[model samples]
Target: MMRKLRNILLTLLLLAIVALTAGSFFLLNHALRPADNKGRDTEGSYAYMFQTYPFLRPWVDSLRRAGALCDTFITSADGTRLHALYARATRPTRRSAVIVHGYKDCAVRMLMIGYLYHHDLGFNILLPDLYGAGQSGGDYIRMGWLDRYDVIRWTCVADELFGPEATIAVHGISMGAATTMMVAGEKQRADVRCFVEDCGYTSVWDEFAKELRAQYGLPEMPLLYTTSMLCRARYGWDFLQASSLAQVAASELPIFFIHGEADDYVPTEMVHPLYEAKRRGGRELWIAPGSAHALSYHDHRAEYTARVRAFVRRYM
Candidate 1:
């Protein structure tokens, strides 16, 4: 009877292990895989943007008609051909911006910010499509880990495209914001002036853990640990290693951190730690009242642009 009970316990343990392995794979796929609506159609995306922000239609149309808006491409270090939308300023200027899009968002989706810099502020802009989204090529999302390198490369491309004398700002929202912080940690060209991150999470691990809990009521123990290990083996990056907080701590360049007070998606609280982490260069934080997630600019367009214009000018 004792031997039978022992055999039963071993069988249950084996089944548990199998269940855990399967769960980890599913979790990894759910988090890293691209969404169905990845914004591949340029016209469709622009239409959506126009519907959401009515003012963009006329401004963007004018730029396109003027031949100031165009597409550009580059080969990444990994040999992936990346795509971006470049918009020249209405009038020639030394200021430029490399605006990054969030998760599952493409270059076209970020054209509002591009409009802010290119048309409103009279600064040229380059907006890149992060891998596996828009027109860029990749198998899976790297969160902000691998994308940071791609953004760094784009900054160089921006420097070349806008001229060496151009003072550039790297600005991103959500996942793109995380990418911007990661880029800040790395050595950058002198032309790269300051950074602006809006509603960015502290780290991939923390964000995933929050999502896991919120979605499935699961804790970050065996499941998250196993999933992270699987991610490292399959994609060359794990959640914990893709840390915006750690990267922010390492950066020496001035950074402007922006988050919406009502942001629960990335959690408004995450920005506090990231703001405190930056000890070098300089830092500023703005909690946009009643704004949600990446909607700070949407809700308070004039204020958002004004704050961004003021913050970047100090560093540039």
Candidate 2:
């Protein structure tokens, strides 16, 4: 009888371990992978996006009609073929800007900033689709971890298209913003000039931990640990190892940090610490009133554009 009891206990323990591992795998996969749209994989939920701002679609169409939008593509370090839409100005100067969009967002969705820089400000703009989003080739989103390297590659595209004399600057919003910070820390050329990051979280681990708790009502201990392990094994990058906070601290790049006061998605508290880390670089911070997440530009376009114009003009 005692032997039978011991055998049953061992079986149950094995089952429990299997359950835990399977649960963690499912959680991470669901979180990182984009949703299926018909047969195609979408960039993830933009449910709140269209309802929040419906004008984005027509605005993109308008830009296309005016001969400002041009298709561009590049091969990533990992051999992923990425896509972008280059915005040309009236004049053919080497001055250029690379505008990166947020999580699940394509370059066309960034028409607001693209128009401000390309058409209005006259900086030849190139907006690239981040890996696993839009036309870019990837199965899962790197959450700005591996993307930092991809943005650097986009700088190469800028050089080839706009030539070596091109004065280049990169600007990113949300996840793209996080990519900018990560790139600032990476080995890069001086010709790339400066960066503008808006509403980006400090690190992938921090963002995922918050979302895991808020959305799933779960803690970030064993589950996050397991997720990180799975990510490292499958994607060749660990979420915990991808820290913009650590990156920006060691970077010499001049950064323009912008955040919305009302942003609860990435949370308003994040940018404060991030700005503090890079303060010695003469980093500029803007906390827009009544703005949420990536809404700072939408809420304060004139002020936002002016700040961007001033920063790039002075730095770039």
Candidate 3:
């Protein structure tokens, strides 16, 4: 009877091991591989934007009529084809902006920001569809770690398009904001002047750990550890190393940090560390009152525009 009990215990342990391994891979896949839309809905997206920001309709209509809204493409170092929407300023100028979209989001979703720079601020704008989102090609999302290299490449493209004398500011929201912070740490062209990141997390590990707790009520121990290892083996990056805090610390360029005071998705407090991480002299922080997540621009359009204009102008 004792021997029989030992055999049953061993069998249960084996089953538990299999279940744990399967569960880890399942979580990794679910997080990394979100639904892809391939940026198919230009008219639909514009309509949604117009409905959300009615003031933008006439301006976007004019841009469309003038043929200022254009598509551009580039191939990444990995040979993945990437797509971006670009528009020249009302007239030729050296001032430009590279606007990045967030996780599971496309360039079209960022047109409001594009309009801010292109129409309101009189600067050329380029909004790229990050890999695996919109029209860009990739197999999985690297959060912001791998996306940073793509954004850096787009800055070079934007500089060339705006001419040699161009001065550029990089702005991103959410995951794209994380990408912007990561890009800040890298060596970039002289034309790249400053960075603006809104509602970005300090690190992938932190964000995922928060989600794991909130959504699954699971602690970040064996599951996060196993999945991070799987991610490193497959995608060449781990959650702990994909850190915006560490990146901002290494950046020499000035940074403007924005966050919604009421934001809970990325959380309002995450911005404090990111703001404090940057070099003291070149950093600015703005916490929009009563706003949530990425809604700062939508909620306070005029103020957001004015602040961004003032900030970018100082550098560009």
Candidate 4:
């Protein structure tokens, strides 16, 4: 009887493993499949979520009623309707700044910077919901590769709304930071005044490696690397090659690179080398002593705000 019970338990374990494997595959397939642009479009997903989770509607409504904030839509080159928020300073300054949020985070989390620049420093802010996040278009998270185009579109929108002569500065955290870096490297983004990148990874592959090691205790190069390669082959874009460190190092634009000394998510070591590479140019690197990943802003709020304000004040 005991032998039979043990055998049953082993079979159940095998079945559980199979179920988990199948579920993971199904979730991945759903995530990567892009929605058709015509009838079943990306915007429909946002509408469904808004209807199901009505709490977000009130939060967005409150931000709009705050007087200084204006919500707008941006259309990507591929006709994707991206959602963005523009905050005008009460004092009406010509200097404009754009803030982009990271993965799984919407433009609402960027309100902290908008409040600082718009109210405290009297600078206008343009905050956009990045692709695959918030009210933006896309299904799967492409990290920062395709998000670069979304950044460019919003920058153009800002230029049109604020005029060509308005000095534009960009501030981003995590994935947004990577997107900002990629955008700054583009020749069309030259009108940007300065850039602020906080806690951004050096490459998408390295980030995946770190995450995989944490979860599975296995080398990510062989598995995650191969998976990303397959994703690129399927999506027609290289996911592993998305990065801004090399491009930013060779650029003439002023850049402020900030990272937490204790950041384990995308180690400061990866960013440190790039920061060192750009030391000769218009660059400033700040590593907060006790911060971790995205917590650098909260850990050293005063210093972070002061340094960012100083940079923008100089360029803008």
Per-residue lDDT, model 3, residue 272, is 95
State model 4's lDDT. Answer: 0.72
Q: What is the lDDT of residue 225 in candidate 2?
A: 85
Best by lDDT: 1
Worst 10 residues of 2 by lDDT: 37-46
Q: What is each predicted model's overall lDDT from 0 to 1?
A: 0.90, 0.82, 0.90, 0.72
Q: What stretches of model 2 exceed 4 Å from their correct place?
A: 1-12, 36-66
lDDT of 4 by residue, 1-316 (tens): 9999999999999997676556444433543443432213335544543564454455445656876467799777678778987866666567888898876667766666666676557777798887666677766666777887778778778887777777788888888888777776776555677888888877776776777678678785445545665666666675457767766665667788899999988788877766766644488888989899877877777788898889888887
lDDT of 2 by residue, 209-276 (tens): 99899988999887888888888988888877999898888778789999999999999999989998
- Candidate 1: the clashing residue pairs are none
Ranking by TM-score: 1, 3, 2, 4
lDDT of 1: 0.90
> Model 2, residue 270: displacement in angstroms?
0.8
Which candidate, 3 or 4, has the higher TM-score?
3
Clashing pairs in 4: none
> In candidate 3, residue 60 scores what lDDT?
75
Error of 2 at 240 (Å): 1.0
Clashing pairs in 3: none
